[model samples]
Target chain A: MAIDERMEGIEAVFLDLDGTIYLGGELIEGASEFLDRLDHRGVKRFFLSNNSSRSVSQYLRKLTRLGIPAREEEVLLSTHDLLNWLEAEGIDDTFLVGTQGMGEMLEARGIRTQSKSPQAVVLGYDTEITYQKLSDASMYLHAGVPLVASHPDLVCPSPVGGLPDVGAYLSLFETTTGVRPVKVCGKPNPSMILGMIGELGLDVECCAMIGDSIYTDMAMADASGVHGILVLSGEATAEDAATSNVRMSLIAPSVDSLCR
Target chain B: MAIDERMEGIEAVFLDLDGTIYLGGELIEGASEFLDRLDHRGVKRFFLSNNSSRSVSQYLRKLTRLGIPAREEEVLLSTHDLLNWLEAEGIDDTFLVGTQGMGEMLEARGIRTQSKSPQAVVLGYDTEITYQKLSDASMYLHAGVPLVASHPDLVCPSPVGGLPDVGAYLSLFETTTGVRPVKVCGKPNPSMILGMIGELGLDVECCAMIGDSIYTDMAMADASGVHGILVLSGEATAEDAATSNVRMSLIAPSVDSLCR
Candidate 1:
């Protein structure tokens, strides 16, 4: 399908949830209004996040609780993208250093989890990190298992300052094994964005990415050759956005200001 | 105190522990015999390890268990060195991202541990790393806290391969906080070797760095204009040692073969 120049002409709008639509459990002011405008325009909207801490179903439920109606299929989480990628590669047995959500995601794809001889090492936002787990992951990496990181964020902003996420584990693995990850499949990576665009069969030229973090959201736009709109309702300020390589085409205070 | 070239002229022998005496838990072959020979030679041997996971007392205990006669005062651990250095600098409050051993060592030196308003950041080999610890350290580093790393071994050799040590943490802090450590007070850092040489009242030319790891032990010798004797008892193999920039004066099977 041919893509149009304006955002209204686009078939899909992929949104970053945390720090973009909401902070913590509260929605950003005007986020619901922005969604209502999208609904009125009959444009498809998808909530995408790199956080593998929760499932897409959970994200959908959260959005509903915030008075924004979102279906299960409309939300794309990192775990969902990872499982889809793994299935496409025809992989079965793997070692996971992440949450139970990741384990469930892999199991749902009919992939067997093996600690001893895992074909690949999947890293996610794991809260239950033990020394044994770290040792096993390091061993797997040293044995030349393909390393895949869920995201590249070093820290995730919390209500209190910042928290170490998947990137912390990734750093440890890199240090111990002297091996950097081969692939990172998340919001910032173009492959994930292209996959999302492919589902809608939309032309890349007309799409616009809206999010709070310029590093990920705007970079995704630049990578996909699309326009990016950065909203200052979340993590990044306008000054922070200005310093990025990805030029912001539209500047809005929040998602609510986008419709006007 | 005029330092002489003869082995008998040496009063105190500063020895690197990791590669020279042992690799991980198991003692290097003939290492105990080498210590026995030192006793016969009337040389006061001090076991020095850049590893900050344990204290001097702990090292002494471990060495005593391994059949090497050692006292807590004769063991120089990195944390002990750091605490001494901090005290000399007149710094009382510090933020430490290390083990309980390191914390205890610093506390013994009267340096208060501050998570928020730390005057300096003392990094050590913390086996039990948490996201909160890394986050706090990064913040302190970003705030321009004077950074001092205990050592520079990116990976510590373990029974199960290698694990990320203090150097790895320094790297992570560098990447996240955009600040490189100003000082690394461990082997190969010049300052550490010089400090030990001064304590022994030995000239740099008369001193010899006898250890296993070429990067740390031999590199320290090369940098400080001292003799570097490589032992094949730890981390680096003979082949790996051959290609290093550090001059390998004597390639012995163990420290026992050093003065034979």
Candidate 2:
């Protein structure tokens, strides 16, 4: 089917950040134009990312600098997904093992970032991870303190190589204390986009998920009952989409090809 | 049988450190007197340990500081066993993930403690563990550098509680990269004492292993065909030994009650 034909009745687009709109500091060519086209089509676009290392404000600053029009409300993150889960569970105090940025984000949302006696241990992609943080959190787990992870990504892409992420840390904690996370909130959970679609009273079919990763972005799109658009601009290639069992509504070189 | 009855044929005694001779910074009650008794009984004593964090010199210092006379030659360590394995396997260069003392122990014995291109990644009980060390060693392992650990101890006993040790670290690396140590050298392997017994030209039945831990000390004795003495001055209790399937020659409140 043609791109426009596949995109026909979609009222909203949930877009991934890294590799989708921008790769590192440079924006993907025609990404801003694609966002402009979404506006012209009266389509609501939400910037979604699994990077819990950065708060919404930091993401907003980066998006603005990259020339992508976005607001705080227009951003969806694994952190927000975590906050929603914690809120539902009636937890306000936690021992967080994450970056300073992540701690600030949780504290700003009224969750105590550091509690002497915590109800749970909140984990994220802590780029600034330390041994003490690991030991402290492991001890907590040994003492039966619950663990909640923002994402299950094993490694983050670095210029040098893949660096250990929360998934690796989770493995460490489980190994040390014989305990695994009680809940992991992030992409592939589908709640991040599905909750938003529900709030907007939009049918899931009226929305489409666009990103480079088949495991996360397309997987979430599939579970949320939304249109899945696999793009080759990021980690995945056209060959990957062709070989994968993941159902895709469209396979484009980038968002540049969509809403054209 | 009486205490001396159990001690009848033993010409040498191997002892565990952390729980047998001392706990934390203080020597166990009657421990020094027990050493004196062993000397009077004409029984040779060797201080054995799975604690690779402390070099033999450090252990000597701690023992001397505690007023228990010990010679450098009388100390046996899991590090020695690891070094023995590395020597036999012809691996001289390694990326060491351990404390400064452990590094010195390996480096002084002709092993390169830090190599850009290492033959293996040697792990120990790294009390001063860092994220950089974990990441660097993990990357090396990911690049196919085999891992060798000093011991398989899950936790090191402390005044407060058990602390995560090399066993936990092994699990972490395994979960992170699907890599396990090619060999774990320490107690219960029997090599730590069996090698010494062979060198000394002594029969295994003429030796006795005494310690507070049933797993390492008693298990080593069972594997090496030596008499097993379970002491209650450390981690294990008489009741634990009673219920445990580990065969023991004797169970005493402390080492002081032995060899009398």
TM-score of chain B of each: 0.87, 0.96
Task: Name the top DockQ candidate.
Answer: 2
> Which runs of model 1 end up more than 4 angstroms from their true locations?
A1-11, A40-43, A57-69, A112-114, A157-172, A190-208, A222-227, A235-249, B1-8, B190-208, B222-227, B237-249
Question: Candidate 1, which CAPRI tier?
Answer: acceptable
State which docking tier applies to candidate 2. Answer: acceptable
**Model 1 lDDT tens row, A138-254:** 778888899887788877776544566777667767777888887777878777677778867878865677888888888887788766778788888878877777766776777
Give every collision pair in model 2. Answer: none
The deviation in Å at residue B85 for candidate 2 is 2.1
DockQ for all models: 0.30, 0.32
- What root-mean-square deviation over C-alphas does model 1 reach? 3.8
The candidate that wins on TM-score is: 2
lDDT by residue (A97-120, candidate 2, tens digit) is 888888998898899978878899
Residue pairs clashing in model 1 are none
Point to the candidate with the largest lDDT: 2
Q: lDDT by residue for model 2 over B212-257, one digit each (tens)?
A: 8888889888888888888898889878888999888888888777
Per-model TM against the reference = 0.86, 0.87
